[model samples]
Target: MKKLSALICIIAILPFSLKAQRTQKPPLHGKHWMAITGKPLAATAGAGIFQKGGNAVDAACAMLAATCTMWDVLSWGGETQALIYNPHTKKVIAINALGVAPSGATPEFFKNKGYNFPPEYGPLAAVTPGTPGGLCLMLARYGSLSLEEVLAPAMEMAAGYPIEAQTANSIERNKKRISQWPYSKKVFLVHQGEKREAPEAGEIFVQKDLLATLQKLVDTEQAALKAGKSREEAIMAACDRFYKGDIAAEIARGCQEQGGLITKEDLANWKPVIEEPLHINYRGIEVYKLQPWTQGPSMLQSLNILEQFDLKSMGYNSPEYIHTVYQAMNLAFADRDFYYGDPAFSPTIPVKGLLSKGYAKERAALIQPGKNLANAAPGNPYPYEDRQQPFQKLLDIREQWVENPGKDKPGSFVPKHDATYHSENKNEMGWATTKDLAVDSLYMDRLWRGTTSIEAADEEGWVVSVTPSGGWVPACIAGNTGVGMSQRMQSFVLDSILDPYNVVAPGKRPRVTLTPSMALKDGLPYLSFAVQGGDTQDQNLLQFFLNMVEFNMTVQQAAEAANFNSNQLWLSLGGTQVKDRQPRPGSLLLNRSTPDATRSSLEKMGYSLQFGDRTSGPINAIYLDRKHGSIWGGSSNNGEDYGIGW
Candidate 1:
């Protein structure tokens, strides 16, 4: 007990906090409601909304508005995807404001130029910025506040706000890369007609350009209202000002000057879609996720496969437990790399078939009790479909991806990437030759970086969870607005020859990693949550929920649980595996909480275990005690996560 206590104490002092580290900490509880976010001010923003007679949605919007400017990890200049549960409808709905490819983007565009590495940053990486429109849509449709009201906090932030020590460090870490692009440098790197040094931890960081841009949107909406437009119409007017007016012109001019693909027409045509959410019943609790367009379904499929096991008997984080979970996740991820994508783009995507219980049972049976599969290949749920279509596309684009097929080399896998955004700016990082980029593991983890997530629940029984990232880094700040560019288009395959699910298609939304989740207990709303790891979002969520339902941990304890991420699937934004992609053996990463004995047993079971990334995801979550009308709110103690409640 003494030795274990010492280990726990050491973990608590680490710069990056993990779930097991919270074993000595207490859960944050409240009577009225709770709000949690990656940024403390963002959390306060939501709580402030709650105090101002707003519901959960309103609080979420307010938090989002303030959060975009507070952290460099997530931004409104990028895109936002959310899963909202409306008590009025008694249903969970998804808002898909994910950025879409420029209308001018096509397979020939890059192939004609002899391009191999697709640039994920700079003006060329710009897709129509979606977060602004998505926020407006959320407020106009579901929230009580106008866009102006919610954006007020954000505007103040942009004008001038004291930067946090963490934020200053983030800027310092990326300073060199930001300096490569003149416009991006203008806002983030330069100040007072000279190259600005990194600010002190508590120094004021201002984005006057961003303030002007945000103020213009508010002004536009007010003008529309004064012109006799209804509240909804005025909100839409604000959205249009970004996508179709001067802001659009600025983006178009920048992209055109840089020989990029986006145009005014692309911006004008962009609008976030509404999609049907997917859910699975796990031990009487139905967990919900955004459709497979994200990596969300990976968690649902894993849960379905895991349902057949006696998890409690296996023991948490034990050799049996870890191995079983890994196998289940491997099977689910294999399916994800083969079948998940934008349903709007690939009508052929077998979303229902992939999620079917029968399919999960069939896959689960393949897990060997005492060993890891050397080659965990993908399975075909619908053999009748043209499964060869994606392969044929690969053949067409084979020349661009001409890799030295190392059939003779033992353990040779296709090239893999570790970052989310690869830039043409030369200085910007996050691109690759093959496989999906695992952002946090690649570079951001050391700098205490990841995506941003938030959760809020109110006295009125309204609940929401939102994950927002894919901005600031791998970003092309548009014009002089201080609005960072989006690399979400990188989620699209480089060629139309690839599967339609992620093919480079004009106006098609790319399969993204952003997923916000909610859970229904015996048909009643119970929990809402989200996390910040790129590919690990789904995998981490799985670990968190299991800690609670299987181990009987508190909401905060679950939020702090250690997790393992399997990096075997060559999934692109959660879509089909790249054809000719070499298979890598299933590798698992365990947090420090695992015992040496357990590690040895898992290694003996033919699993390679690495120790790093304490929490599977830096999570932010809220759980409601329906019986007492009370709430428990918490953010991951690991990484820079924060939470607040009343």
Candidate 2:
């Protein structure tokens, strides 16, 4: 009788146990519009724009401006990469606002400085500013509002705004570096010579120069409009002022004074290109990402490979599932590190071949069933594109490097912004032996390097997803423009051995990790999403998409899901030495909540595991609920990412 009662008790608890747990934050529901971003105030800016009778593109521009002003891991001088879904055309378009290496940024220039890659910070690392022009182009082309209207929120914030703790603390912690540039020191060091030289949390940090600069753009636009220019022409006039007028003169002067390479010619020559995004069909859903210049296509490749597997049967977060995902990512990233680069440059990338399902299958076939493939090298995609392999010798050299990564000279890898953005505790550095801990910390820093994402959508079917980055804290403020210079030049490789396609060159965009994602089902917008980690952006995004599709989790649940990261790919940011960019094959980061059995199985499969409480992302996403005639918004609980829907 007692045994029967116990069985009944177990049966009674089963239903509740099987039910999904309540999320820490509720999903945002909206019928008219939804706006989500890295910072709460930035999302509020988007919401304000939405309420003011703006479309998704206008709202997104406002949010981008606000976030850049607020220094949400980016500034006005940073690059802006976006994927926008236009309801009118029923098409998705990509915006490539990535900055280019300035006039003297050749490989020999950096190699002569005794650096393997570009320096991690300072004026020397700056590329020509892209955000300003990109924002203007986006607003002028598709937006319903004027530049003044879209920039109002950001201009207000630029005049004066309460600084958040994260940015304030970052400024304080890196004050020594900030003090190196006179303009930067003037703007960021509000409490110079004090125990804390940066603005306190909640302090009203003012940037008078920045405000003046924004005012100049608005004034230029208004002047152009008064002169009978069309809205688009007026916006372009303001953009031209920044690139070719007095503003350009000041920027060039400032950059040169600070020992940077950006010239007025570089700025004037640069323009944001609207290109067709690359995509692959996974099951019935078509997903889109920026071209090879970004690491976006790697996720598509991973999805194509995983489509062949019975992922649902393997179960979510299971050892087999994680291993399979990891191996697929490894294979895709291997191609990314080798073949992905600015398409406008020489030695054309075999992108057609790389995105081929046949190519994915061939790569997927290399995955070991019971062990990690530690030496996964780049595969031949040229054949798939009907082209001959011209770099067979380079591929052989890459294979040798994969087998012996330690052949490169090892140096100390110090990631200055890790503490400021991620809030990593230095005390946790004691988790392993000093040497192992240093490697782990460096890998973690590279994996979780900072950026910010923006997602916005409207009832009219317009959607915008953006991943804008660079010019984080410890940034060098260029002249008196109050705009921090972009440190994106560091992502370039100084040697062909590191990345032949991404070798630093004048007028070439560095292959960046920033990527925005969008999905379409049956010729309609299904999901718009993005995240903010450097190398880990696509890794986290891949799992987030899978969580919603295969596992049938809510957008919010997927954003907060327990996803694992593979450290078996090249680092895109941080480190001045080649060793810092080398892959740490078999290293994996798993959520602390992972089952012990799964952990043991992964360990036995030759994986070196590391645990983290929050392993997934601060991913922001919007799912169009076509059936419900509403939008479902998801912002991860990991950070201050917030969304407003109404």
Candidate 3:
């Protein structure tokens, strides 16, 4: 009897022991490693480059190669904006590899047609893509690995690699779109043998054509270098093959034949935008991001507002801390909607002024305890377009008095506007789209489109953050390039809080919700963070940053921690905002993993909660242990194969 009881007890504890073993930190591996955007093959490919004595750029090249092999939806011929920070130089380089709008684009065209721009500005929105150009340029300037050495890993993977679940999902989601493009469909859907068939799990996938293209570049490099030319010159010579030489001619012909906007002049004129990276100081740590046209500054703005409160004392994910963070984020988003635009066009866009310390202090002072700020107004830095200017004009006209000053404001008269504009909008759409005017009017308005991507190069000790868009929908791919077309109009969505006015503007890069950032403390790399959730990127980044900085959580812990996110542009249930509540620290809504204690506290803070999923965005990151002198990178399993090369 005694033995039986002892055995049972041991069995019960055995499960506990097993659980502990499962949760233990992964055993250490040999150092000097690399991780890329999530995918096993990509990881292997990048590791191969690292092992081959290639630096991060080589690894990045390898990583991109793997992405081409494993995931076409988010990789390949796609634009890449990178911020490569050379730890050695202690300086960051921003690479704008995004495609540019056709010279044909102009904003007046849309208004003239009396048509809202299409979801994705299609043929009209095509831009000269710069992924290949930008990648080659970076290699020319700062890369230690030769083009062949860097591209070899990718070429191998493209020549053959295994397909994963994520790839399948992407194919299915965009099946119709993929099928529409001859090259995309040819490679993605129907190729056979060792050359093109989609691999089942554990099988190798390959891209013979892609490999051939890479090989040609390598051949160019060798020919140039053997002639006693500088390696940079050799690489540039190879790059010309893609931009100004045979490749450009072929691409130009493809676009012209397919009714796309690209011309040989566009390709030849294509030049990568190289600019100084934007940097900001947050809580004694200097953070960095790419400039406007992206929501990178939103993170800085949120951090600035967060610095006002004792967030750490409030605890990680607490309702109080989250509410404060949410409010700050909302304000920052308001500014993003109102002022963020392409600097070349919108000179009045106060990107610097908005990020100024004075602005942050003023915004942070608005937070009130115990209740929400009813009718909370977005920051009005650019009120010229909204109220002040219009109001002053009306006053100048000696307009008749109303019930109240507020009564005449748009928000106050929403009920009246809704009653009038809702029906009027439908009637106007009917008249505008009449057959007589449809094509001509639509053509009159220059449609704008956009694209966004992140790039990392270890050789340069940096990453580039960029969101370039404005011109069109990226649906039509010039067959020769095997790259998809961009219809930037899709960026204009009903989802943005500013939807009605969300039309794409001429020469405007469009207000992107992308917030790519690198966090550091005491001059050491702490995190490389980015998420993809449209406008939610900035909102989500705010919470994650707070979890790490204010809450002092480990990178993994901070990233994995449960939390809520608000689309400052969207609405919530219960006639209230979906908030990160108070009482319970570190509690948020988007994450169902949040503790019950945190939930209860948020409830007390007057928030109605909603559960969300980990698929919010593919959040990818790297954590550096300053004291230990090590770099640990991981991609969230929450969405797709995001942490592929980690």
State every prediction's TM-score relative to the real structure.
0.86, 0.93, 0.74
**Residue 133 lDDT in model 1?**
81
Q: Write the per-residue lDDT of candidate 3 for residues 230-324, one digit (tens) a residue.
A: 98999888888877877677667766676665677777776767766677788788877767656678788888887888988877666677677
lDDT of 3: 0.52
lDDT of 1 by residue, 1-646 (tens): 1221221111123433434544533566776667777776677677667766777888888888787887547666678888887878888888888888887677667556554324545665666778888888888888887777788778888877888876666666677766767676766663434454566677777888788889888999999999999988999899999899998898777666656778889889889877788998988998999876788988899999999899999888878888889888888876676567778777778777677788788888999887997556556566434243345444445424433333321111212222332323221211222123223443434324567887887777678888876565535577777777776765666643333466667887777777898899967678888887666778788888898889987787787778877766554432123332333454566776678898788778866555554554677788888787788875666666666666
Instruction: Report the number of backbone clashes for model 2.
Output: 0
Give residue 279's lDDT in candidate 2 (0 to 100).
92
Stretches of candidate 2 off by over 4 Å are 1-21, 405-416, 419-449
| Cα displacement (Å) at residue 331, model 2 | 0.4
Residue 482, candidate 1: alpha-carbon lDDT = 70
Which regions of candidate 1 are displaced past 4 Å? 1-25, 112-117, 191-196, 383-447, 495-500, 571-583
